[model samples]
Target: MKKKLLTVAIGSAVALTIAGCNSSSNSTDTDTNKLLPKDATIAFAGVKAPVTDAEKRAILASDATITTGSDSMPLDLEYNVFARSGDTFDHAVFGQLVDKQGNPLSKEDGSPSIANSNEFTSLLPRGERLFSVSQFESRPGAMFLMELNQNTENGELSVKDAWQIDQSGVNGGWVHCAGSVTPWSTHLASEEYEPNARSLVTGADAAADRYAAGFLDYFNGDESQWNPYQVGWNIEVDVQADSGAAPTATSKKHYAMGRLAFELSYVMPDEKTVYMTDDGTNVGLYMFVADKAGDLSAGTLYAMKWNQTASTGVGAADLDWIDLGHATSAELSDYIEGANQLAFTDIFATADANEDNSCPDGFTSINAGGNGQECLQVKPGMEKAASRMETRRYAAMMGATTELRKEEGITFDPTRSKLYLAMSEVARGFESFKKNGADSSSYDLGGPNHIQLEGFNRCGAVYQLDVASDATIGSSYVAKNMSALVAGVPATDSYGDGVQNPIVANSADYADNNKCHIDGISNPDNVTYMSGWDILIIGEDTGSGHQNDVIWAYDFGTQALTRIQTTPYGSETTSPYWYPNINGWGYLTSVVQHPYGESDSDKDTGNGENRAYTGYVGPFPAKAE
Candidate 1:
């Protein structure tokens, strides 16, 4: 049997040279003036590591203070609420429903036309709508168009009413996760929790299929066409218009981006290239290059294949790209119409056939009855359905690395030219390097062709991948150097139930069993980079032993992390978004989901008390130069 490659958590810092920033004197600092907040009172360059839990407790106990011009405790951006729980958020965006002339539809009152729109209103409070056990239903997730009104007298800025764009999921908006603003000024809303149909249904026998059959219920309405393949594509919303008009937003699912539990998509400066992160177990990192710049409808997809020099999940390694090919939804529909389960199976069997018509080495075969078998290798004829629908399985067939566990948010930092990927937990057979105060070497070579790194721990991590400088469209690329920006200490005990019970340090004075010590950034989830300020906003979604999830700001320059805000107990801080110059002041949007937690009953049926909040933080005035 081939070894399953272990997911490594290696982090090593490199000297960074600021990119695109000009070096000029105070009088001639035009570029500097443009990048810096015009009324910047404090310099927001570096960050400080997280404070102790006791310190955090005291800090939370008191009102957050912002001392202007204070370098030690720099509070550059003042945080404020945009929308709270039960407001217009908590719903999903279907797409930017546009007419023939490409204008957004609206009613006489200027409210978006929800009727003609394709947003599925039924899938809200996702668990209730899909599980079939609950009569109560919740709303889908939504995107807000916030208006920042500048105060004429004090030069302060505040957010006006954030108008609702559109809310429906008819075109596929299930569990809207992390998002990104495209170079063309559009919002890319991603879908999470979409199951893989090929591996879950067709690949298994009736007995095995019965266990996985429930996943087909993820898509409602048309059960005939509704398979695990439909919901997980990157859903784009056109909310990037100017703030003057009641900013109308629309949505569209990019079928070419591959259907998976997407965390987010980051488009490169080149406009045509995009990096999409899959937020699930045993997933792959993908890159999509559009046929035309700024047009995402058609594109080619590729997955990453790692070449490791060491076994530790940490450190530098080379990355090879596997082209999975591409096809549109129309083409896919046609292919599926002509191909049945037996046809799809034959496609794989034909590709799996060697000269002797036997499965290849390292490939496993499972009986599908009546002498039909399925092989775990790339079948040349299976690219179409596999690429866009059964993405993870397709990548595996193409020899791409598939050991990543919960590969969450991916944000590009233009200044450092580095892309940061948050792996919620480092433990999936990866052991810690410093176990019991000594070097414990347990790095193993696992996965196909020894293409995966091995390590330990259930603590989380953020990987800094430095891709090539001149990467072009459709070109295979490698991580020039890959390092862990920050890695949480491995969990001490998980209580034998298999889930990690991270032992966090209570005080900065203490060190042992401090798995959650690095200033409480364990289980890092949604992340985004404020390029102008060089701040990486990281949010958390951790399990027990960790109280409320907090959002942190990590300064790449100082290598320090500071906890910015704490969510309600048992809530996950989500989607830390930054939009510069919203009414001349920078603005951020984040959410706290399922505040105060939820019960099994609450999840099954909608509980009015259990709600998610969409917060708007920022509008900090520019300080004197």
Candidate 2:
């Protein structure tokens, strides 16, 4: 396949002619016909530095020249803000909380309660029509469906109808963070930062208390029916849309995947293997291999063990897996609905450790899921239930590494048989493991210290994992090796003296705004890999690493990082996904979430409107063979 350059101008509304681009070297002719050429490069020009204008810094803005290659083709890369937090479409208000019958819930002021933190979105095409499912990242989370109308001739998209998906059937979602579309065309969403069951039950956690308040509000103040086990599993939603009627969505929680604070779940090409990332401190990386292809109802769960080879530059490791047992979703669901309800005490017994951090004779001391060191003993005859329901604790009990910090988004590169995972920050247990080593009692308590690093990098890093066949797991896409593909560069002061920030006050200089190198990524949260193009799109969710979160495009061929977009101050760049071809039109979806909600909470404009945005970067022409 031959390649051509495509130039896109912002705010111009110009259109470009379709041209043949490079095809993937390993891709088949049929696959090549469906995607862009492998040699074709998507590059961004201009903007050598971060945004400095105060007005521009307060809004979502982009000033980059998007081009394909050397040849010139006129295309307009437009920014579309189609949906906001409180906007209404098709008689349904976005981000609005709803009841069991799908009616909108009201706030104390009698206004419709809305979710401000919107995260992942999946665009699914059905015949000539398109539908999108978006998740809200809040306590007692929510999800909605939108019918998108695309002008095939002009490559423009618009939402025609929208409504909230009913979640009462599987209990309400909690902190739906990020998601992906399955090969079978279902939306796979996540429930992040699962409330600590023991803490919630004992009223010992203030944060859990706050979460329970919001969750109780969702149930119309029904405190007796609250259940913490119902919200942490991966949820799969199947949408069926016909020609003229509203789409119907059916959802199920896959309890077989084990309970964790899931950031997202990425399924491998084989369909039986899945990689799931846990999102907080002292978290563990997990994998689930389904008993049958294309089904997640029953699977074997495994935790990662990082055997370190080098302790420099984000480190390197040979990966091993620890089988954590398995069960069907039905079995776990039965436990949730049964008379016992599987409370924290039913599966394990806990006790306070001595001042020296030593556990009793029968209890094991372990740290997992940012809960700090805990002394616990698994009850007899409840190991299977504990493995699936109290996953992090059980994994730690089985001697798996649980020192990962802020593990975020995941994407696969089938051509290279590789997987990319984002670690939002390289601190907390990650730094402690390096300083204390595996033998130290201060870190990794009861688990092994598989990862060791040289220094702390609060700016974070992106890791690449090699996938291969594992006979024991009976999957062809098991992750075998892990290493850092790219890491953020921590910045020093103007005098090159202090590693930490020297400028504490707000300054007019642009260089003082960020603690990490402005040219590299910081606190990368969501990542998407464009297969044929060899481009990785990285988004940031940072409060102090960078002043304004950015969306970056990294080209593997040239190893160049380009700043494609920047969100408002205190906002996050989320859901950077690429849909290669959707009815002869392509899109790169991007969402700017919670403007001025993070770092600049007190610096509101006072216009009475602060809503999150959901939109995309382009409608690139989809070429056929």
- Residue 119 of model 1 has an lDDT of 13
- Per-candidate local distance difference test: 0.50, 0.76
Q: Count the backbone clashes (under 3 Å) in each candidate.
A: 40, 4
Say which candidate scores most in TM-score: 2
Q: Report residue 24 deviation for candidate 1 (angstroms).
A: 25
Off by over 4 Å in 2: 1-38, 46-50, 58-70, 202-208, 354-356, 433-443, 493-508, 623-625
Q: Return the TM-score for each candidate structure.
A: 0.67, 0.89
Candidate 2 local lDDT, 39-83, one digit each (tens): 444555523344544533433323332244565443445456558
- Model 1: per-residue lDDT, tens digit, 1-625? 1111101111111111222222222221123343443322223332233244322221121112223233223233333433333233223222222222224444459754332111111101111111000000111233444443444332233344444444444333355667777776666777775644444443233124543333222222124543345456777665433324344556677777777777778788778788888776556678887777788888888887766656664434567778888666556654433344223353344335455535668664322111223456546666676677666666766777665667888887876678888888654413223222235322112234332334453557888888664354353333455568887654345322233545645453333423454455678887888755667988777754245466777866677776666644345666777655432334456655555462122322234323444434444332223
Off by over 4 Å in 1: 1-79, 88-170, 199-222, 240-247, 313-315, 326-330, 333-374, 377-381, 429-446, 449-454, 470-478, 491-515, 518-520, 598-609, 622-625
Total clashes, candidate 1?
40
